[model samples]
Every structure is written in structure tokens, then in C-alpha cells.
Target: MKASNGTTQDVGGRRKNSKREDESGRLGEYGQDSSVNGTKQIGATSADSSGENIIRTSVTWDGRSDAGKILEEVLLLKQQFLDYVKSHQGRLEARLDESKKQEQKFLANAEGLELRLRKALTIQQTKDESDNTEEPE
Candidate 1:
């Protein structure tokens, strides 16, 4: 490889003079052009491309403003909060239904006991009347 100047530095750090030519015969930088195929090129890393959708949206919507970034974060947090609320609401509703069923069962049991007590009272009254009517020995 050669340096920016026309000096070709060898593998052993020995400098040799040579003609500098770019990949496309340009006399300056030895790489691809700033644009390719008549369109601007963007070299995004793996980490950058991972969130490319978010970055594009942010740039398009707000032109790289701080408030725009904050808005995106807030939206994500709001979605998480909504998801949590939905999950907790489902669990709460199930528990409430269970409690209602238990209360109904207790109420039905109380009503059944009340009916039995009334029946016992009627039987005792009939027995007392018969005993009073009987003659003494």
C-alpha cells in the first residue's frame, strides 16, 4: 500500500517512491466514491442497522431533535405500561370473578341453613303440642 504522498511504504517500514493512483485512477483517496450508482450511499454498522427503522423514523419526523428522541422513548415506555396494565387487568378480573363465585356459594349455604332452622322450629312446636295434650300417668 502507498501513503497519501507518492511514497510506497514497504511491509518492512522501508519507504519507496512510486506513482499514487486511486482505485478508479483518481490521484487522491484510494477507495470508492462518495456516491454509487448516482445515489448517495450510507454505510451503516450492524448495531446501527439493528435500529434503522427507529433512526429513520426519528430523523424523518423530527430531524434529529432531542425532543424527537425523547418522544420515541416515551412511546416505548407507554407501550410497555399499557401491556402491563392489560395483563394485570386480566388477572384482576379473573380474581374478582372467583371472589364473586365464592360469595354466592356462601350466600346459598346461609340460605340453606336458615331453611333448616325454620323446619326444626316447626317440628319442636308440634312435639310440644302433642306432649301437652297427652293425659298424665
Candidate 2:
């Protein structure tokens, strides 16, 4: 079987009898032997030939496996999401500040208009009073 890391392993659960030339002319016992039963095959034959099959059903990961890479990608995405949120928060704060400044300016303008209207009303009232107190020719 080929792992994600491009390493080849014998997953056929066979025992190698002797070193033979494979179809690719490789002088290694890495080929699967049909004579050996998958259920009965153990680890590389020991010197004692105990006829015991040491089947490793699990793979040991050293942080370079596919799952590790996926975890790293997830963490990177999380950081990116946090950064996006922070950036949006800064923009929102700036917009809020700008809105507050505009509101203050508007309020100041309204107050100035109100003062001008009050002064005009007072001048009109004084002019009417002086006209009423004058003698008619």
C-alpha cells in the first residue's frame, strides 16, 4: 500500500520466503507471496521462525501525516477569520467616530440657527413697540 507520504508498505499481510527478483528486477522480498495466508502472516520471519503473525493494524503519525496537515490548515483559517473580524471592528470604530463628529457638527449648526432666529424675533418686537409709541401726524 502507498501512504500519503509516498512510502510503500506491504499491506497484503504476506511473509517473504526468500529474496527473489520481482517484475521490476528488484532483488528484495517486498513482494506479496500468495502461498502465505493474510490472516496467518506475521512480521518478518524471526531467526526462530515462531510462526507468529505480527500484524500492525495502526499507523503511527509523527505530525507529518495528512491529519496533521489538515489541523494546520484549520488553525490557519481560524487565525485568518480572527484577523478579518479585527479589521472589520477597526473599520466600524472609525465609522462610528466619523458619525459622532458629523452629529456634533449638525447640532452646532442647529444651535447657531436657533440663536439667529431668536435675535431676529427680538429686533422685530422692539421695532413694533417703537412704532406703536410714536405720535401720528
Candidate 3:
């Protein structure tokens, strides 16, 4: 029921002591000293408790190096994609125009057939009227 740090725990291994304090007045359960060989503390700044100094460094990439080559390739790929899209669009437009032309040709043929049918019907009617009038002879 008691941990090595003198904190009382429950039967289910849950900590019962809510205010266990360490030497620095920090909670012993949460603020255990995470120092390596008591020299540098984890998540601490560049200074230690005994005034020990630590150096930090940063890294950067030059734009005129590999980064520039990658950017050029990316731009070329983007241009290629744009060209492909434009080519497809032009082909689609041409196909659309061709379809419209075909539809117009079909419509013209339908109108011509309708007109011929009307003329043939009129001629037949006229012939029937003449035949009926000549029946008295």
C-alpha cells in the first residue's frame, strides 16, 4: 500500500497520497527528477541546477541547392499537368463541335423528309378527288 517514496497507494495500484512533495516542493509522483547522472535534466533549458552550461544548435537548408532542383522538377510537372488538361479540353471541344454538326445534319434530313411526305399526301388527295368526279361518266 506504500510506494518506495513514502506515498500511500490503493489496492488497485492507484496513488492515494494526493500531495506527495519532493525536495524542491514539487509533486514527487509527477515531478520525479529526470536527470541523467545528475548532470542534465530532461525537458530543461540550456542551464542546469548546478549552473552547468549546455549548447544548442540549429540546422537550415540553402535554397540554391537540392531544394531548388526539387522546385524546378515540381514546376515542370505542374506545367505538364496543365498541358495535358489543355490538350484534353481542346479534343473535347472538337468532339462537341463534331456532334453538333451531326445533329444539325440529322435535323435537316428530318425536315426534308417531312416536306416530301406533305407534298406526296397533297398529290394523292388531288388524284382521288379527280377520280371521284369522273365516276359519273
Candidate 4:
């Protein structure tokens, strides 16, 4: 539903009430709040005394409304995130390789032990048979 006052949609597709700040950082259309820095933050939601939906949109400005600068910042953040993911993937791959190497080594050692055990059992059996062949003396 649309309100009497024009409302704008936010990045999330949710309708912003009717509270918006101008580039100068004034609340709605009636307020004077000057900040030391060039940054201004506005974000809130409430119902005005008139029972109208009010949504304060948050926007940052350094002096001029430069969409290019904002886009650049977003791109830079994305690149940083991608770089972090790549590094993490590389580390995980290294760990997987090490684990595979360890598994192979363990298998080899186990096979060697098994062979030695079988050889020892065979020797014991042969020795017993030879003793039995000898007559009581």
C-alpha cells in the first residue's frame, strides 16, 4: 500500500516510510543538525503524530552525491572478500594433501607389520614340526 506521503524503497526492497534526509543531513524537511565531519547517518522508523509511516533512510555523503565513489568502495570490498576466500581454499587444499600422504604412510607400515607377523608364524610352525620328527631321546 502507498501512503499519502511518497515513500522510497530500500536496497532490501522494503518500503521506507516517509522520513528522508536531504544531502545536507537534515531530518525530514524541518531540522538543522550540522556535524563536524562530512559524514551523515540517518536510519530509523516510527509513526509520526499524524499516524503516518515514517522511515528514515541511511545514506553517506562526503560533500557531493558521487555514485561512482560509492560503487568503487563496493567493488573494493568485494575483491577483498574474494581474496580471503581464495587464501582459505589454498590452505584447505594443502591440509588435504598432507592428510592423504599420512594415510598412505600408515597403510604401508601396516602392510609391512602384517608380512613380518606371517613370516614369524611360519618359522615357529616349521621348528615344531622338526622337533616332532625326532624320536624320543
| Candidate achieving the largest lDDT | 1
Which pairs clash (backbone N, Cα, C closer than 3 Å) in model 2?
Answer: 42-53, 42-54
For 1-137, candidate 2 gives per-residue lDDT tens digits of: 75767887757666577654575555545646434555545455575365545344235555557997778999999999999999999999999999999999999999999999999999999999899889586
> Which clashing pairs does model 4 show?
18-55
Cα misplacement distance, residue 98 of candidate 1 (Å):
0.7
lDDT of 4 by residue, 11-60 (tens): 44556686644755643544554445786534342431444443433253
Candidate models: Cα lDDT each: 0.81, 0.79, 0.79, 0.76
Structural similarity to truth (TM-score) of each candidate: 0.48, 0.50, 0.49, 0.52
Give the alpha carbon lDDT tens digit for every residue of 1-137 in model 3.
Answer: 65867786755765788775565555445555665776746565443334544332222454545877778999999999999999999999999999999999999999999999999999999999999999986
**Candidate 4 residue 85 C-alpha distance from true site, Å:** 0.7
Question: What total of clashing residue pairs does each candidate reach?
Answer: 0, 2, 0, 1
For model 3, what is the error of residue 108's alpha carbon versus the real structure, in angstroms, after optimal superposition?
Answer: 1.0
Residue-level lDDT tens digits of model 1 in 55-88? 5666575455688778899999999999999999
Q: Tell me, what's the RMSD of every candidate?
A: 18.8, 21.8, 14.1, 19.9
Clashing residue pairs in candidate 1 (N, C-alpha, C atoms within 3 angstroms): none
